[model samples]
Target chain A: MSGMSDKEDEKKSTKKDEAEIVEENGLVYVDYVGRTKEDGEIFDLTLEDVAKEEGIYNDEESYKPMLVAIGKNWLLPALEEELVGMEVGESKTVEVPPEDAAGPRDPDKIKLVSKRQLQKQGVSPRKGARVEVGRQKGIITNVLGRRVRVDFNSPLAGKTLVFDVTVKGIVSGEIDKINAVIKRRIPGLPEDKYDARIEGGTVFIELPKESRYIENVQYAEIGIARDTLKVIEEAEEVKIVITYERPEELKEEKETQEDEENEE
Target chain B: MSGMSDKEDEKKSTKKDEAEIVEENGLVYVDYVGRTKEDGEIFDLTLEDVAKEEGIYNDEESYKPMLVAIGKNWLLPALEEELVGMEVGESKTVEVPPEDAAGPRDPDKIKLVSKRQLQKQGVSPRKGARVEVGRQKGIITNVLGRRVRVDFNSPLAGKTLVFDVTVKGIVSGEIDKINAVIKRRIPGLPEDKYDARIEGGTVFIELPKESRYIENVQYAEIGIARDTLKVIEEAEEVKIVITYERPEELKEEKETQEDEENEE
Candidate 1:
């Protein structure tokens, strides 16, 4: 009887493991706290009050809760790898090293430019002058012999950063929003679908009847959607569906429809 | 000799503590990231690619790092509270409950409106649609009798969220930019500063002496200049120089000048 009970326990454990894996495939939601690794300064938070108080808003709207999927490079590789097995409603603290966080600062990034460049730009490069070139901004670290050294390395590089993160909810929804989010997150995916639905907390996407070779893409897209929705909803119960039809089947149906049109 | 060694150890410990504090202060810069705690999924890393990415720009500049004093409530209060005494180059994970994170879903924020109201505003609320109202976007959870129950609760409510955050850099110089960031981060500060600078990685602000009161309100204005300078090198630094000659002092000088004119 004891052995039987142990076997039952093993079965239960297996079931739980399967459920966890399935849950991982669903949408994920989370809350987080971020700080600079160098100074232990908090940079961002999802807390409503914090967002409001900090005024990180668009016309008074706080930064919306962010969403992403597993296995997609939407986040740093280190962060993505850590999120793989997280379940809905589960919270975890993961430490991302400098390489995984923002990468180490590179000395090569810092460049020195002549004062003539500053004069051409109509800027006075003082001992502590800062300037922008295109999208990059640099502070004048030293003004020596008409040359200004500017550091382009990320300020937070080579520092270990900490984050207190909570997986809040997962999203499993209609095809349009899901696809929109996916496209927004991963720009490389092609756009072609016939119908889509979310049922029993899962998303089902169908391909056009004339389409060919979609099984692998379907699985990958579904997995991506599942993980993204999980982060959006911060919930565990998300499902996805993908359907594809062959071109031969579509051609036959079209011929039949042409015959019917003639009969009519 | 033992006492001397003990004294030297004490000095070394203090030096280490000071270095840690300096590191913390030096690690100021800005980046953007999105994550959830419940699932540990990161959706975005604005800091890493802010300059490279094109879409997330405001006023033709990407959102870069801005400085916020620790415990200043410039960010989420919970997140700010978590950052105290954190050493530079170290990362840690913190968990913020719903109350501290996104706050409990507010039922009062949920409302039902007639379809006509949406039509009046040129909005179409479908069965499961999301709409924006006055800087707040709510999702349509249900529709009944021309009424739509839109949950104003953050899309991330009740879920643990994660943020792979790092203090990329501190807002050290550019008083105008620092002041602008401060105003955006913390309102109610006055705007009276005429000059702002960073020396030895510390922020220095100069105010118009004519203004009898120089309060935090000025911080926000200075922050704006600082931020603008961060993006535009040609932007000029603010300088407030008050040269006041009291009426009594000027009176004697003027009389003497008049006597000289009469003699001439």
Candidate 2:
């Protein structure tokens, strides 16, 4: 009986392994509906009707929904954890609490700033308007004489949010499109060696000579690149080429291209 | 005096337009420190404290920071609005409110499920441990008796997240990854007749049969071919040949290649 039980356990483990292998890099597409918990207001939806009305995508293509890997951080951490073992072609509704979803609101995050700062920054602090304070951005919770109260808290703070997500499809590929967006957030990467590409539904990036040996560079690049690529779903590769060409050199290259085109 | 005022307005508009252009597309790199608003906890940091870490990036290479575009949805709307018109290399401390950040928590989003459901699904529910429920993969909030409570809220909900973001660099290119990612997300795309290439940072995708007055069959072939070519980001040009060969004929070609390789 003990041997039989052990065999059963092995079978379960084998099945689990098979499941993981099948989902290793397959694409999963899904449609989702998100709503605010407090008022049950529909905040976001991947449905065609709502997406079309909201102009969610720049093109007029029908809403194709979002895609995510089961164990990947394609979504938020908590959300990704929940999606790790789901099978394709399956649909289910999920309910999340504040802690597991967006978490409870923090009161200390609310602050009042002088209107002079707004003026200095050439911004008008209006009621119910969102604003950026300091180097980070915040929303205007309220406005009073000469003072605007902004909450640096998340919009869904203290409110329950519901997501009706449908797994649509799944895919796997190398990393791509990392440094392009990362450079926009950070700064000062030499131009010559950093490159990114997407191929076979994967994102691939090559770092600059300066960053070739950094472990964190690889980690952060891979992490953010993977997440960003997952969000887009169709990206097979994103290549970012880092170099040290001056602005004038780039301008010259542009002119040369134009000259060639004219000749053609 | 009226003419002078008009001229001043024109200058301001031009300045704004230039700023918009700069903000619209560019590459940047930065160093950042992230904090949670709930209790002022430092959740993440890009700075490393060791010499070995510094060596990873070679010369003054730091961890690549998050990137954002002024008018793009890359950053939160509130945050992007604030970043507009800011000079490069400028440093500021920004605080984001929960509402504008992740938003408040909600109670209605929490759902209660039965232990029988867990048993049937072969999952063990533990207290304080987050678990996914249903096909949507909602996070589990709590386990009580026969019922498990779950939350679908965002983990960052209602928390003011702070970032010490820097503007690093600027770049311009076609939104190649975005299109590729979107295409990959949707299934059943034609695999022929499509060709894509990146030159001068712009991505050009060509559909052979759909070029102008091609027939549906031609279009189909082009679509299939293009889909195949889309996977190759380095190919300057792609040629697709559609042949009405049977499965046996294709097998014969493969066998011939194998025979040649074996002979070699």
Candidate 3:
């Protein structure tokens, strides 16, 4: 009887693994760390401790899992390809060449621009300053007496990238997919601030009182709706709900004052 | 016959003056210059040349006549009282006592706060910088070693103010009043960005495409609606219309490409 039970448990585990394998056009959540191939210097990471140890932790930002739609070109082509068939709890290191990454740097993209031109546009030219010079956006590589050298190449160009990607989990369920899309579009929001419910192919998002006046909230809503419809095939409508309330402290003080008045 | 016509014209002009006289609760527009009574130094002015001569010309801000709803406490009580019964295109100089203006400056309002406290609160205490310390808003008057002096008193307090006011025109008509309220709430918007039209009791405002995504536009809309109801008794509804468009340069380029394709 023990041997028969062990065989049945192994069969169930294999079935679960098959179900969790990443597929084309599947929505996946991942925690990733990106490093330069040459020196292995960490450029980006979603893990909090790894980011802090790399001296890039920002208290203002909340590190969370990133949502990726496979085969949609949301990520580097090579990286996305490698991520395919990755099961939940799987980790992989993908090496991407310069061309497959941000492309190789071109010397011809560097040009000399007059400092006065930048000043006229209210941009102060300084060495290592990122600025918009004419029609091209570039970083000021050098600032001279009357001219500045602006390099329009991508900062990570000419360098191969190595990404250590871990599939945290596969986001399944229509509601979870909606939440994942919202998380991707409007990241750094606390999980409790919004609640998502789906009924009859419609998604209703309840927004916290404090989030109604957030900057670019309308854009974020539109982005969430677009991405939700793209990922969740059953969702046909997305509605954002905002309920107004006085600030918490003010409301509490008012309630206390009213209680005192009633007692008197 | 010429003498008879001239006498009749004189009577007509007097009647016109009586009709155009400013009244209590009347909406009026004015162009004014505020100067220090002690030195006749211009402190503020709507006239470009006067502002230029005073070395206070700001190229970024648009200078235009200010709108006033008399008896609304929008202006200093003394100044508003003096403006009553003035005629259109008339100019007046009103001297307002300190008590009726910003009120007397209180020395007790000035206090020294530690620079470290300000820094800890992420407030940079620069000399002449306006900052909010605790619950009171104040200006930094001095920065000493380890301490900064903040004065909560108004900058114009303890001094009589002199205003050279000229009534540019009296605002009449429901449409004009609505426009004035919008201008008052959102000053410096170019005149062509929005067009307001009234139909029945509803006001339809066509907003520029660029303004639809502007920050605090919702708050501005609420303010305009509130002020319109207060000023224009006939208006009952304010509707904002937003239209989207491709950028002009991109649209033009697309059209040129289409033209080439059609030629082929």
Candidate 4:
């Protein structure tokens, strides 16, 4: 970005003098702890040590400052709305009503099924077992002698949520922001794995070797391009490169086979 | 390419004067009609109308001149080997032995199974019903009340094959040749859907919109890049772009929602 002209348009209603503030469509990294209002029970958080203490640590999850695109609903709508106008390193506590979060629990979504029918659908008729009916993931709350009750509402529904959130950083600059956008779409790999550059209005991305055989990467490619174009105004195009290079060992492995086939 | 220096390296044992001839790793297009030597049965051919006349038309196949990467085994090993050193418009009839085509029929491949066992494997015990056992596809030869006979050998394993092949053209020039490689990997889409270009040492591809939701496009991306690098020789890198643009209708649909969320 060339000095004055670029920053002026990106700035909107800045409360502090010469400080980057959050705005709609801005990419920001945040650390947050979400809890239910009824019991103040921590359900989700970004700190690994805290999760370990709370007995909610998952081996597969990478605990990092969550990246959120404001106005995109990556967070609860109420929480995201409160993030606007906040500056980097700012901390705030926000209360979200059930409507703005997971929505009020719908009694109509609950159903009772015959035990035989549940068994026929391959669902074990045991209490607390997870089940999916009509594409809704539900919990089998009760298993009577001949009938089972399932609740399809989301676990957090109908409960107000409270969050303690800190804006760690607001992503700036073209390429850094593009990398952030890429990390949002393809989260399996670290940001350092991808080499990104901008030249002649086109953004070039070199994907890491591990992504070459990943299934359905075309969706990630489309999402990356769309999100980059929507957030990074100057990026005219996004190009991703996935390379499969033969290592020296593989070259040696094919030599005997090459010697055997002179025609083909 | 620096004209004279490059052509001298690519040319290998050319038979004709100033005419580009096929060599090892060259890309060529061919039209062929494959027949069984036992009864001269028309089994496969590239021409669609001929397939219809012979009562073997298949709606799923795209009947175009077959693109073969010489020495890559896209065809039978003997057939691909014969493609080397051939020039455009040359026609030849080649006879292939059973061993070279599909391997000699194995006597041990014939097996008898109970009809109940075939039914358990979800195979109908009718004569000529296709069945797959232990990853080998076979056809049922006889069904006797409770006993069934299946031949695990390939249908053409014991027969000599004849192919009337004509070399239609050799794919030359970097861009045209790169498209061919792309088509070879992502066969479901047309070549024109991807706009490919080479700048500096990198090859850039713009994938079609329909490919975004395909189940396993990463495999194709890797295959295309590897094949291009191995066959094209000049490409040092490959970059692919997939774009998802919001149409005017979708933009109009979101305006009301945008107006409602000013904080986000």
Which numbered prediction scores highest in DockQ against the true structure?
4
Leading candidate by lDDT: 4
Candidate 2: what lDDT?
0.51
User: Which ranking of candidates, highest DockQ first?
Assistant: 4, 3, 2, 1
Query: Whose TM-score is greatest here?
Result: 4
- Runs of candidate 1 exceeding 4 Å displacement: A1-26, A52-62, A122-130, A134-137, A172-264, B1-264
Q: Which candidate model has the greater TM-score, 1 or 3?
A: 3
Point out where model 2 deviates above 4 Å: A1-27, A53-63, A172-264, B1-264
Task: List DockQ for all candidates.
Answer: 0.01, 0.01, 0.04, 0.24
Worst 10 residues of 4 chain B by lDDT: B1-10
Give the winner by TM-score: 1 or 4.
4
In candidate 3, which residue pairs clash? none
lDDT by residue for model 3 over B107-214, one digit each (tens)?
999999999889888988899988777789899999999999999998787888999998877777677777778777766566578788878866766556455466
TM-score of 2: 0.32
Output DockQ, candidate 3: 0.04
After best superposition, candidate 2 residue A167: deviation in angstroms? 1.3
Candidate 4: residue pairs that collide: none
By DockQ, is 1 or 4 better? 4
lDDT by residue for model 2 (B26-92), tens: 3233345667856756655555543244343334544444444333355666666555555444555
Clash number for each model: 97, 120, 0, 0
For model 3, how does the per-residue alpha-carbon lDDT over A53-172 read when each residue is reduced to its tens digit? 878898976787677877556678788889889877789999999999989999999999999999998988998888886577899999888999999998888999999998776766
